[model samples]
Target: GGAFKETDRGQWAHVVCALWIPEVRFANTVFLEPIDSIETIPAARWRLSCYVCKQKGVGACIQCHRNNCYAAFHVTCAQQAGLHMRMDTVRDSVTGAETQPVIVQKTAYCDAHTPSISGLTPNANYVEDTISEKTREESRNKMKQARKMLAKKRSSVPVILIPTIPPERVQEIATLVSITKKAQFIQRLIAYWTLKRQYRNGVPLLRRLQSQGQTHTGFGARNGIEGSPDTSELYHQLKYWQSLRQDLERARLLCELVRKREKLKVALLKTHEEVVMMRLNPVEMAMIKLLDVLFQKDSNEIFNEPVNINEVPDYMDIVKHPMDLSTMRTKLYSKMYYSLDDMEA
Candidate 1:
């Protein structure tokens, strides 16, 4: 209420007042009680939208008494908006009346409900309006502000603190982007989304680099992305930014690897039974059966028991580590290998 004066009702009281609302005149102004009932206003006024607040069912509202104008509003709202609150005074008959005279009727009118200077037109109701001039006036003001802002437009992206890229580089990127269709010569270069995303990311990165000093320089420097000092930060600071950018890039790559590892883990779990069976080494009997092939790696004597050193005296020297298929069968029955990997090893 710094700029506002307190009324008879007190500071900010009129806004909350139920009796002091539009279409509600005080029957006894002395105590400001015994207000004119809301029943006095037409039901249509209650239903009509209030142009000022654009809401209904809040309080008693007054409407444009000008015929067919459904415009309704709170009294305070109407007064602030400068709508015509016409009062017809009772003149000369009453002797006890004050010099100000007696107001017999109080009526409100909208912008479109102004009195005709010539005479009453045939379609006076059509000329009258509701949800009228006040709402339109506000809309018009907002439209004017937007128009003013639009006047200072430019094609180039504006820089608040630091620009994303050098103006020339941005222009080069723009030239490449302007041609969207695939051209054999520029097929690799025409990455519209990549260019846009990098440009978008560069904006915040430049701001961070500028604010954080040399901490983020090394990363962008290694990648040859940081520009001249005239375009961005100094050389050493750019180098620090390059380091930071590289660290962040590594972090991004590691995150992708971790995601793939988790997916692989889930896949392994789904086929856990098959893997377990493979590790069980159930091929011991199969290997024994395969040994039946006669003299496959050497002589057919391998199917029978080992030849004794007594019969062939050179056997102890030549076949010092010999073991026949029958000996292998005995080892398999003894459970020497628990898994296929162990058996192969």
Candidate 2:
């Protein structure tokens, strides 16, 4: 009845009650956000009778996070009784194999459920890591959905690996690579996604290593060979993954080599053209200018026209090689003349 706030979901909660609960958050300072966080309190908590108030407080009750302990209480009642409630920051397990860990807030409703602070003695009954379990559950559900979607036979549908990593890992990889290493990082990430080559679970490289215990068999378990050969499917499975990894490494090396070859090809072409131009074009240009001046200097233009074979039948006898202005111009235009000496000849 006192100072109530309405949520976006049309649910009303007492401001005092909301303030006491560690899970409730105000989206903004000005609005004092009546965020729809009431659902975070498990529905089973409502059914459990509150030990503090001795009432079945539905919609305004929270349970003890301790395992096998169904202790329930209202936020106001818990606060009045001086209960140990807190928001703890911990590593998020959903972001698997990331270089950097994702830190998230988790509400601790009991002293027993609270994580052991560093430099403090551990609680004997603290068996479950609530945040880790929650994140894992979320990851499992998300990967399942992604697998289902990817399994469809739709044409042109791009096959994207289920990004089991959180956004922070993407940012970390972005920070790790410079603009020049863009291609290298792209290839590396591609190889990273191509793990196992099975197109099955998007389990991270590190997680996959941890999950596979098939290779952990004890040595010399059976009496010699014959009956118990070491060539089991479990042993071969490890080798299969290793071979795939080797292939991926080779592929990465090949990609790098190809990139280098492309760069070299471009550079070689440019330099070759430059050397050719430097050695040949200037001499050709000077000869062309000389030819132009000589042609211009022919005042009567006698040499400009070719001597008709009939008019001067002995012209070929006098000149061993046939030459004319028109032929020279045609050769120059077609780039058939390799040097100034050839053009002059």
Candidate 3:
């Protein structure tokens, strides 16, 4: 039989007991049941035992928690597990005082099975001082050598002098020859005027001597006169004729000399002309080559085998000189007419 009357004191005592107990038993079963449903029980469970105190329980001590809580062990086991658990009951064998649990993190050791963390040393300050110094010295030496090599490589070409005859000589010769020819021409005119005056004056004297029946001395007697006809006048006339002949010979010699000089001048001018022509010939050839390059229809043909005259529409622009045009015409005429003439011959 159960007492049904409930007092406040009894109910308060029951609540206090429920709070004090750490584990609550539901339906007197060892396994925990679901709190929401009576029919459901916990599907999986973990049996926790304190490894340090050798106690079986759900809540482990802090020291045993360091080790696997599921492994049950005594205080000695916890010390052996490297988790130091302090016990008031146990004492050290050597010191005769209660042993304090030493809590040190279990370190992994290196062996055939485990990894090691002891051999590694700090490498932050490690340096190859000697090798770095050698490399810097080598680089500086290379730079200095390069600068010296560049300085040594600088050089200059030697200057040379070429000698040449000056053009002033040609100009001087041309001026002298021109002035001499002009003076010779003027002397010839003066000589002709002097001979005319002498011939006019001698005519009347010869007539008077013939009328007076006098032998003209000198040239007059030699020409078949009997009287001595004015010897002085006769001598004057003879000397004038001799002077005229000498002047004519002198003029002829001067003309020959002028001709020789003119030929030399022409030779010099021809040389200069030929030099200019030689320089112009290359330019003309280049112009012709450019024209051929531009107007040719066939891509394979570099230059026409025989250049087509009709293809060059602006041929006159290239061959502008009258002499060149005449030369070309004469060449064409000779090719056409002389060939026919030779065939007929």
Order of quality (TM-score): 2, 1, 3
lDDT of 3 by residue, 1-345 (tens): 111222223221122112112232232122212112212222221234443333454322222222232333323223333322222233335631232333322222111111112322212232222225554455446445543543343343333332232557545544655555765665564456456545554232335544333333333544444343455565567778867966886687689779867877777787787678658664443443444444455455533343445897775687663233233334434553233233223
lDDT of 2 by residue, 1-345 (tens): 247777758677787666655566654334566565766755565676755545564546677755566666766555554445665557766643432254644343443343435323224443354335764455446444543443342235556566454657767777876787676776677666766432645534553343342235321213122122343544556567867866886687689779867877777787787678657687766667777887898878877877899988898999878877767877887888878778877
Which residue pairs show backbone clashes in model 2?
A: none
Q: Which one wins on TM-score? A: 2
Candidate 3 lowest-lDDT run of ten: 107-116
Displacement of the residue 97 alpha carbon in candidate 3, Å: 99
Model 1: runs farther than 4 Å from truth?
1-27, 34-44, 92-103, 115-345
lDDT for each residue of candidate 1 in 132-226, tens digit (9 for 90 to 100): 56656664564445434433332345643423345577556557654545354344443453464466654443444444443343234444545
Superposition-based RMSD of candidate 2 using all C-alpha atoms, in angstroms: 31.6
RMSD (Å) per prediction: 38.8, 31.6, 67.0
**Candidate 3 or 2, higher lDDT:** 2
Q: Which ten residues in a row have the lowest lDDT in candidate 2?
A: 218-227
Give candidate 3's TM-score. Answer: 0.19
Model 3 misplaced regions, further than 4 Å: 1-229, 283-345
